[model samples]
Target chain A: MSEALSHRDRCAIAGIGATEFSKDSGRSELTLAAQACRAALQDAGLTVADVDGVVSCDYDLVSYGAIADALGIADLTYWGQTGPGGSGPCAMVGQAVAAILSGQATTVLVYRALNGRSGRRYGLGAPDPDARVGGRGAYEEFFAPYGLVTPGQFFALLAQRHMSTYGTRYEALAEIALACREAANRNPAAQMHERALTLEQCLAARPISLPLRLFDFCLETDGACAVVVTSAERAADCAQPPVLVRAVAQSTGPRVQPGVMYPMLMRPDITVTPSQTVARTLFSRAGLGPSEVDVAQIYDCFTITVLLQLEDYGFCAKGEGGAFTESGALRPGGALPINTAGGNLSEGYVHGMNHVLEGVRQIRGTSTSQVTGAEVSLVTSAPPPGTSALLLVRG
Target chain B: MSGMFNDVAVLPLMPVEDDHDTGGFFAAARRGELALRFCSECGQLLHLPRQVCFACGGARSEWRAVPGRGRVHAWTTVTHQVHPAFPTPYTVVLVDLEEIDARLVGSLPGEAELEVGQPVRVRFDRAPDGTTVPNWEVEA
Candidate 1:
């Protein structure tokens, strides 16, 4: 396929906006969504009236039409919802790009809002019993009975395997958490702002699951984030400098089924993951490599996830992430400054939406803890069964 | 299988449907056995068994019996209990079956003794209903 078909002639993120990271927004999810949407439009020098398309994750209770109606945007030409939690941000951006390229709409607004901290907590356990009764409940039914109910428990198992197989240490994982905390200390909007964590502190934190301390997991927060995507041509007319969407791709691995391990074991390698497929495809399409990335906003739902993604994205050789991260490679002055906005670990988890906003800020040179001279950014999401990568460049 | 606890309220009993067929999950107890359905036309083993085959968009499907022998693909010991239904410090396992291309999840009777890739056989326990719910026992 031509560059235009593969990467060019697609949508660009014209503006990005977010609510201040908080443990609790003390407001409804709908209100949070509207605030972020309005802020994004203001940043783009556009109005809510300019957005003709909307896309979001499937789990969001708020519907596309509801957002459009609340934002007072007239007739939406395109609207879509993608699955899996953390992957939504990247997938929604891709959907918006596709919508723009296909002429379905000229301006697409993608947003995510969650009261994950104060409201219903996903980490608590399996889906509600009502959800398990129907066909949709099949996957949960298989695991819930066996007590593999929460994401933390499920990922902890993977962490144990990584530790047992590669001798990865809990202290090394704590270092990753510390780096994120130190970075967030410089970010005024980070939920854990100015709260520096020491290895001792992390070690003292209560254990949520074996091999995963409370600090190792992302924070539950009530927040919202939104981004605007429009044609590159339209972006030129906008007020702020645009962040070109150089490439965007999504992929699924051999075992697409959630909570199943057959495909994972059948694969030739346990360390190498399908997220690499997304990264490889994205780099090839964007004509960039790991060295060229000035900054990265990797999804850090869990520290192990960040480590796994580092390997899968070829930032380091497989199983080398523990050591790579331990060497301070992710620090601001380091080779690849990851999660400069503190990431899900310290920045509060908005379903990885804030990471996308941080990417836009890095290119704009407006981040609170900006990576100086940064021109290119890599944003990745490792939703179970697959990964999504997006290459964004400063315009 | 004979000594397996059938009256444990903690254990959940449900049916397994062929990925291709969704008429209803075949009734299985904690130790019961049933085959996954497949599309006769497409030969595709269905999961989350539905009324119609997702492959080839066909509707015809039939279940075939197979020995419930498998190996552990992955397992986790949950040390904390977030839900009231489950007791803390239990083990959950994903087992890859030999006769079918699918994998299933169940309690790891004794996870400390079980290793990854260890052989196991399905042992069905009688449920409140006449059907059985499938659980696993390490092969002798």
Candidate 2:
């Protein structure tokens, strides 16, 4: 193992901000990106001038230069973007940390903004078949021709394999949807806040794809979320108590990364995700174990993602994810309260950026479904086509 | 095989066109055969056929035929409509080609009840435009 001269606790998430979670924001992605960045800077007690760096998801419709131009920042010393959308939330922060630690820039703005519902729904199946740009058409031809077009369908293939291999039942999947929806009920900002979900409801919900019902899928939302990252010293002076970035790691399982989102089928075992590789590096660098994580914001792009991640992240033994979730460990005040602010399934999917904002809240003790004394917060990105994770602790 | 796909009849049968790397896979499908690319240098089978061998970095590869028999590794009955070309209620299956050590995805012609490990075989579906795609059927 390499020396643990890690950059743990060297920087912290100083502030987080977001627009109202909704189905239609009626704003351009650039506007949403700019607004969220402004709100985040204000929350950090900093201004556009204080932001020497910017980091965002490459999938974000708004570019860093566009955000910089919109925010009227005179100059930016560093700017970066990470990929494949949902897998980028934690990695975006990791990029900001790299920029900060390497003295490339300081006071970075990490943001993800999208009008997912109104502009272009990600779940809306295959793209234009005529446009072959970016090689998407080529990769998609294999699956799209078979009607395996959407992320839900792609993931369902894996979920089906997991169920067959481990005897994982649909009830476990329901438990995940229920836990996240129940958390969303307490979060007023969540799109599903006013709606409550029951086990019967989730079970009765129509199947979008077999093994994954309607409720098993995440909400198509329009919103933006941003957080300010700075060195530990600068974070202490911010408006909110610093949620130290203890560790950050991103990885792709060997040979599992192909076709970006559709490569899950290529794995030797579909049930295992890239989270297993990321978990080792994340905890080793944090100098903490999964047991020490007081709360978690596991990426909930799909209910199965959480179930598989539960096993892959070492929270429970492999093949025991179904039982672990059914044990009520993911509920508020349970062994590990997850998605306290609703997560993608309920809160809103600004991709997984909202999950990061919620992690900061859990550590700040401001979550609506707060884990009483959550000092260690775990946030993970999507599991396939590469994955990323972050370990945050109270400063 | 034209009437064989009656159960899966949709407005547009093909949602995507084949590109350079996938041209061979589609061509093989049109010829009513299952051919996959094999790396000449490293002897690796490339499914979802790539131009080069990711395993050996070998650019030399040729199309090779194998028995189009496999087991249903996973499947899903897609009810929600995402594209207008594809109507509701079609079963998509992922096949585990054990012999070739490769995997392929295709849609079952009907709402066939399926389970993991069920033996299946591939069949070719030719469109009116002479486009042929490989689909799966459960082996008796």
Candidate 3:
């Protein structure tokens, strides 16, 4: 779908860093951002002076100028914030690649920092007066009056439609939950690392929304993850093997059937995600298909979101996501591994920046649950709206 | 605030803001009428009220009354009170209007079930402050 972006693979992720994912950092998001940025710069064998551009997703409170000031970097040329939600990590990387290739800036650092738990939980309604009553508050005005809020409720509607149409069972969703938790148990950094989760446990978990249980929700975490994207030329001199940015594209679906929180009503079907546009363009731009992907770090804001992404991204046929994960296929020792670092379910949610880190680790072969002979890793953002994805190859 | 005949006692967790783009729609709902954004240039119906029409990019649009009837497109029941103001175990249904290619997210009485494609009709449930809010029910 994208005929341009011809400079594909011209830039690469030379460094990756993160503060530990947790429930409370006991500090400000600004401190968390600086720590991650310094570690990433160090990992790249480059000092803060080398960084000229900064990129991050919108929800992150720290501004690029604030970060640059914190890092004591004097020369600033490029900076940006990708669109809202968990869909911006890879997009930020893409922006860095574009900026570096165009010579707008070099040594671009991308990060996501938040006190998601200790400060502001995304699941809770915004307590601010402006967000609740100002012009942009139309979002709240239209839907909140009916108690139709929260990401869980929104996805629940999408999940039920997928089930009613394709006969997807609750167990299918349970398998996804179980696999992510199992992977988390093996990864020490995962918040639920020690907790054993079974199908029965998931099924018995209290329902948050009728079709979704507590386990289906992503943990509200506090932390930051950062990566440095630079030119392939500069990356060649870095300390670590660079993960090449193979291809990247972003697009949303036509508003056919607008939902409360999401404007996607006019889409041909509810089960289909806006990721379709990105997936098509991503595979086309990379000159690769789903089979070429060695492993995946699909966004898992909820268990059902993973299923929708699997089908939308062509990992499996639509409505076949349930069977796709039934065999522990998404597990470490399975056919197709997913969310190796425990994902949002087991791992802490730093918005979606951790997904990109996992992608880089898989290509680097440094993953705690590293896949065998992994080469190309696919990373996707939350879908069914303006979704985005990136392909990382071992450089 | 036209319809004062019946009032629902449940106060909404938040207030619905009706401005230049949406005051008419909300006013119609208060008067027990369902209004959609109709594009004069393309003869298309837009929703959620915007300045420019999605189709034809028409800037000239007006509110058009439509029958308060439709079918359940999809729905969800919230069992968790993510916000203390929001009551637990409530249902929200997105209705595909019979009059046009648009959808509306509204509430249904706690007792009703929401099956996809089930026929439904629009009704009003006033907030605790007696603000009339549109809702839905299964068609008889």
**DockQ in order:** 0.35, 0.49, 0.53
Better of 1 and 2 by lDDT: 2
Instruction: Estimate every model's Cα lDDT from 0 to 1.
Output: 0.75, 0.86, 0.81
Q: What is the TM-score of chain A in candidate 2?
A: 0.97
Q: Where does model 2 exceed 4 Å of error?
A: A1-5, A129-138, B1-18
Residues A275-380, model 2: lDDT tens digits = 9999999998988999999999999889999999999999999999999999999997788889988989999988899999999998998999989888899999
Error of 1 at B25 (Å): 6.5
Q: What is the lDDT, from 0 to 100, of the residue A155 in candidate 2?
A: 83
Q: For residues B33-61, what per-residue lDDT tens digits would candidate 1 score against the true structure?
A: 44666777988876644446666888887
Worst lDDT run of 10 residues, candidate 3 chain A, spans A129-138
- Give the per-residue lDDT of model 1 (tens digit) for A310-373: 8888888877888888888988798788888889999889988898999889988998778898
- The runs of at least 3 residues in candidate 3 whose Cα sits more than 4 Å from the true structure, single-residue gaps closed, are A127-138, A256-260, A265-268, B1-6, B14-17, B127-130
lDDT of 2 at A351: 89
Q: Once all C-alphas are superposed, what RMSD does model 2 give against the true structure? A: 2.5
- Check candidate 3 and list the clashing pairs: A255-A266, A256-A265, A256-A266, A256-A267, A257-A264, A257-A265, A257-A266, A258-A265, B10-B128, B11-B128
